[model samples]
Target: MRPGLTIGEFATVTHLSVRTLRRYHESGLLEPAWTDDFTGYRYYTAEQIPTAQVIHRLRQLDVPLAEVETVLSADDPRRREEVISGHLRRLEAELDRTRAAVVSLQRLLHPDPADLAVELRSVPTRTVAAVKGVVKQDDSLSWYDAAMAELDAAFPADERTGAPGGRYDNELFTHGAGMFTVFRPVRRPRATGRVEVLDLPGVDLAVTVHAGRHDDIDVTYGRLGTWVVTHALAVDGPIHETYLVGPRDTPDAAEWRTEIGWPVFRLATGTPERAAADRRR
Candidate 1:
């Protein structure tokens, strides 16, 4: 009943539920300036109103409870601003990533069919420097990151030195399997570490160029699969992906092109047993 307000009064002023204010009090993020021992009631002074407003603002910013506590406890306004600004920067970066993913999804759902860019290519035997590893589709990101790191460490900066790429089997894509790969470009050979250099003999393959965010690359795969089937061809070997341009080289998604190849053979109006036996030699 003094000039100060009770917990309920403070809650009304703050526009926060009494329960939430009580939680903040229990969490030590906010505390009453005074308490009535016999009544077990909490009381707050006018000075405490600013603290309540700050808690509301920080919560609105999605700041973590621990971080909010740090900002609240800091005596210097500059220090508090620094902490909030740092958090805002991180949130902005996350927003950008989310926006990119959304755009990529939209492109996937509604792709330009008129630009049905496809080609029949005959790939020849060649050498490639690579790192090899077996990885599940879900963990492909980690696997690829490790491979690229190793390749980058092995090779110096140069023009002929292109982005890291891989070849994965249809089984891996269609029915999640341990993805295997050689990270760098090297000459064709019989064996090389877990990564073996083998010649991919010249075979006419239906090729398609998928351009955009890697997050939605699956759309290209699905479309290309239909292309192969419609043409009466069955996948013969592993799916090979050549990165003509990469994020490291450019931030523009439209400029990124992934050459997808489904090693195929002419289907004779029936289910064709996998022609090229899966092997690493």
Candidate 2:
């Protein structure tokens, strides 16, 4: 038997097509061990089979050609592993996002629309330890985790007065990027890292609780918005979200509760006194 396998034989041995081997050779990804000078025929040695299999596996994972090249050419084994690990991390994150989307779609398709219960709460001015970020909507979730982690490290559980909350600016929804503030209601709030003491102004809020995870929280927001429009005018302010029970409280998402608040003034016959009198009834 000949020492050099023809391209077709190599393709058969590696479960790769002849056309793919030629393309790989053309891209300088997998050059043949030997080439005929006159006929321009390509041949591979048995030693290249393991490399061919590795490249095929990487490609099967949908790894980018550039990254696959990096893994192949990297001198250090650790560097090759780093490229593979990074891609795996990205795949995991994408899987989580896909799972969340599937759950949301299922809920929407077979919805059990229940009447939303809203409460009018008169909030008082309070000082809290907070972390703020100016970020795009796409990055809000990651930024929230980082900022909330910072807040968590600074304040012990015993020091917290109430559930953690966040304020979101309108520009985040309308203009793609805006300011976000995450705060923990703490006794003797102080500045640490990104965390700062913020004096939150008092306002009346029409609040409703959203059950379960945030994947379908938008539906609750829609219902609350409709309730606000019918009952009272929406006052211009950042929207508030209170995580009454979350991952920190319980691993079970079914037990999670989030309070959404829209700042508002009571509707009445056009005067502060009239609104005050109506509230007294």
Candidate 3:
């Protein structure tokens, strides 16, 4: 007998089988402390019991064999900590995605059709203090910030406000790069630098309030477009998004509200009654 247990005794202590212990030995995962030359038997020392327990626990946690080997072989505490921390970060990211999916599903189940607040109204001609520039699609967000800053710096929004407006060119939507504008109400039209003050002629718009982050707001646009089509309206102007509350005003992404406006005209050739009938079908 060695100083401690035989393979069978060690397996009993660890709640593992003799066959599993042998396999572990064969795989060089947990080698025996000593080998009997005469009898060709395996013997493990008392000290090896704790090492076996660690391997068992790690396996239960579903850690890969290679990773387990690396962790076990690493003597440095910092290196092991780094490996565990990396896995934790990945798990946290997955948890966030799972939570977002849950929120989306809940909204689908108890959907409030009215919760998507939409209003159709006519906006009259107005002079707006504006900033316009050519912007790439990838740079749209930055351009929006710069344009808003310029507007605020020029003629900040006050109690006396007209329609907050934006005009994006077709290329901005189709080819992903073109002109953009941000404007607030002004008394007179004029031009300053790339910023051009202009009159926004009267038009009807289907406006919807999106009460959440900018991400996934496209779903709201889709809903509003369907509403317009069913109401016998044809989209005639560039899509405009006016920021009601932004990240700068409230750091919480949950509280962000943006108003999406799509300009439309009465479908010239179509009758509202016919459109309503088609919508029913």
CA lDDT scores, all candidates in order: 0.72, 0.88, 0.73
Model 3 lDDT at residue 147 = 77
Q: Output the number of the lDDT-best candidate.
A: 2
Residue-level lDDT of model 1, residues 144-211, one tens digit each, is 77776666655556523455567776566667775567455543223333445544445556788778
Which stretches in model 1 have alpha-carbon errors above 4 Å? 1-19, 23-29, 36-42, 45-101, 113-115, 159-163, 186-203, 266-281
- Please write out the lDDT profile of model 2 over residues 3-53, one tens digit for every residue: 499999999999999998998898888999989898999989999999999
Instruction: Judging by TM-score, tell me the better candidate of 1 and 2.
Output: 2
lDDT of 3 by residue, 1-281 (tens): 34558888999999988998887788778899888899878889888888898778766666677776777788998997777667667777677767766766666576665745666667677777788878898898788888767666666445226545577776897899988877877655566665676766777677898888765565676678887776766555777777777775789988887888877664333554664456455
User: What TM-score would each prediction reach against the true structure?
Assistant: 0.66, 0.80, 0.54
Candidate 3 segments whose C-alpha is farther than 4 A from its true place: 1-115, 156-163, 188-190, 267-281
Q: What is the lDDT of candidate 1?
A: 0.72
TM-score leader = 2
